[model samples]
Target: MAVSDECKIKFRELKAKRSYRFIVFKIDQQQIVVETLGGPNQSYDDFTSSLPSNECRYAVYDFEFITAENCQKSKIFFIAWSPEISKVRMKMVYASSKDSFKRELDGIQFELQATDPSEMSLDIVKGRAI
Candidate 1:
């Protein structure tokens, strides 16, 4: 599937920030890769300061891509943090097909995992209930 303009814009914003992580899911392989993108998250000041270089300070993010031809888009959800803030903020973004934004939106919703104190989380994409 092609990456929508909206998705490109988000990537540009992330690129400009110069720090973020991406969790890209490859459908063929049925796996995801959580890696650093153009830059590191700019929030880890403590660790950043202690690092050998400035690149050490940045936000860590994970992205999941839905690449089934049957599915034209994917829902992206992750935690965003910054030194200016006290708590981690969870955000949701969507990558929709140019002609099927509505369909994609209908298939997506968020599931918050606040009940688990050990690992509070948010999932924007819930393809299956299981």
Candidate 2:
């Protein structure tokens, strides 16, 4: 599947202007498109809750976290969420198409794939930030 031009533009807006807190993308009509965007005020819980329990999606989250040294830092995380309950065929398609999709985003700082939410839990994200 190809990444749509709107997807690229939205990513650029998120990266350059912090226009969004998170972006959820999905395969639509053979193109990867933005399904929804979290506003800057949205929390991590909000983003996580936005994900459907039985689906596959690609997301980018702006994670602003406090470091062990008591400093503030932010990282852009590219996450591929494919739950075990989702269709195997859909998982395969998402897995195979990930590289091509993320490559177009330009500034993702961390890459994570989750077959289960625990794998991409807050602790894991914090660990990556550390």
Evaluated with TM-score, which candidate comes out highest?
A: 2
- lDDT, each prediction: 0.28, 0.92
- Backbone clash count for every predicted candidate, in the order shown: 8, 0
* Model 1 per-residue lDDT tens digits across residues 38-123: 33443223322332221111122323345555544333233222222222221112222212322322222332222122232222
Off by over 4 Å in 2: none
Model 2 lDDT tens row, 5-63? 98999989989999999999999878999999999999989989988899999999999
Q: Where does candidate 2 have its weakest 10-residue lDDT segment?
A: 121-130
**Lowest-lDDT window of 10 residues in candidate 1?**
51-60
Distance from true location, Cα of 85 in model 1, Å = 17
TM-score for each of the candidates: 0.22, 0.95
